[model samples]
Target: MEEKCTTLGKLELEAQNWFVKVIVAEKTPIRFLRWRRQQRLVFVDKENERMQSIIYEQDVDQLDKLLELYKTYHVGNAKIREITGNTPILGTSKHQMILSRSTYIKRTEEHERIPIDHIYQFTPFSELPEIADVPTKQINLLFSVIHVFPPRFVERTKRNLQDFVIINEERRALILTLWEEFLQSEAPYLTKNVHTMPILISFALKF
Candidate 1:
C-alpha cells in the first residue's frame, strides 16, 4: 500500500504520523478571542519552509522546556512527532490553517559550534558564484563594514524602516539592507564604529 501524505492543515483530525526535518525558528505569545493565552512556536523545514504550531496555557511546562533547549543548544535540526489534542483551531484566517497542536521533538543531529575564524572556510563571500551562475538560491558571506547609511522610512503597504550598510571583505564590497528590527538594533552600533570594527556576515538565505 502507498503511504499517505500529511499536510499542516490535516494533522489533528487524521490519526496519522508525519515526519519532517525541522529547525526551531521562533516562539511568541499570541492572543485568541476572549482568552489572552497560548504560545506559538515557529519551525522551518530542512528546505526553509515555515509553519507555526500552537501551545496552550496548560502546556506552559512544555514551552519552558523547549525554550530552555532553544537557549542552551540553539535547537538545530530535529525530528518532531505530533501529539494530537482536542485543541480548537484558533480562527478561520489563513494563519490559523498552518497552526498545529503540541509536538514532541528529538534532536536528530548534534549542534556543532564553528569557530569564528573558520566561518569563511565553510562559506566564503569571495567564492560565491553569481546568482545566475549558481543552481542554488542561497549564498553565505563574511564581510567587514565599510560604511553605514542613515535609516530611512520606506512606505510599503505600511511605513517600514530600513538601513543600508556597505560591507566588504578583501575581494569585494556589497551593500546589506537591514529591515525594521535589525535596523533599529544593530545599525546604531555598526554605524558608530564603521571604519574601525570588523563585522562578519553569514546568512543561509540570499540577501
Candidate 2:
C-alpha cells in the first residue's frame, strides 16, 4: 500500500496524523521572544503552495539544526493551527504548522515537482510609502547592496542586528536591517563586496 501524504492546501486546524513532503524554502533566525527562543520557517509543497511553520524554544534546538534551506523532508505528526490576532507579517498561508517533540521529520530526496526557486512579489521602494497605511506592513524588496555596516549587539533586546545601505534601479536608497542568522550568514560576504553592488531579494519586510 502506498503511504498517504497531505498537501499544504489540504491541511486544516482539526486534522491529525497527517504527513507532508515539502522543501524548506525560507527560515528565519532564532528570535528571542519573552525570553524564549523561537524560529519561523516557510515550506513549499509539490503544488507550489507555501505554508509557514513555527518551532518554539523547546523544539528549536532539536528541529532547527536538522532543517536546511532548500532541503526536502517528510514531516508528520505536526499540529495544524489557525492564524489569529493579527495579519501574518511573513507567511502566505492562512494556517500554520506547529512542530513539536512528537513531530517526525525524515530527510528525503528532493521532490522533482517541488520548485526550489523562491516565490516572491518584489515590492518596489517607491511603493512602500503607499502601503504604509495598510494594517499588514509586510512586503518584499529587491535591491543592490551599496554599503554594509558592522554588526551591532543590542543590550536591551539581547540580539544582533546589521544594517545595509541598498538602492533600487530608480536610485532610491534605503537602509535594510538584518537580524540574527542573517548577520552571521550573509552579512560577511556582502560587507566585503559592498563596492561591487551585489543584488539581493528580501521578503516579508516591514515598511
The best candidate in terms of lDDT: 2
lDDT, candidate 1, 1-207, per-residue tens: 012223333334333355444444445434453474666554443333444556556665555465432321222122333433544222211232122224534444345321223212235555655562553343556577777777677765455554445455455666677666466556777777877856655444344
Worst 10-residue lDDT window for candidate 2 reads: 110-119
Model 2: per-residue lDDT, tens digit, 1-207? Answer: 016887888888878878888888788778787698988898887777778999997899888889888788888878888888763735557889888778888878544335666555678789989997786666777789998788899999999999989999889999888888677777888898899998876767776
Instruction: Give candidate 2's error at residue 48 in angstroms.
Output: 3.1
Clashing residue pairs in candidate 1 are: none
Q: lDDT at 37 for candidate 1? A: 61
TM-score per model over all chains: 0.42, 0.78
Model 1: ten consecutive residues of lowest lDDT = 69-78
Candidate 1 Cα misplacement greater than 4 A, ranges? 1-129, 132-136
RMSD of each: 10.1, 3.6
Model 1 / residue 155 / CA error / Å: 2.6
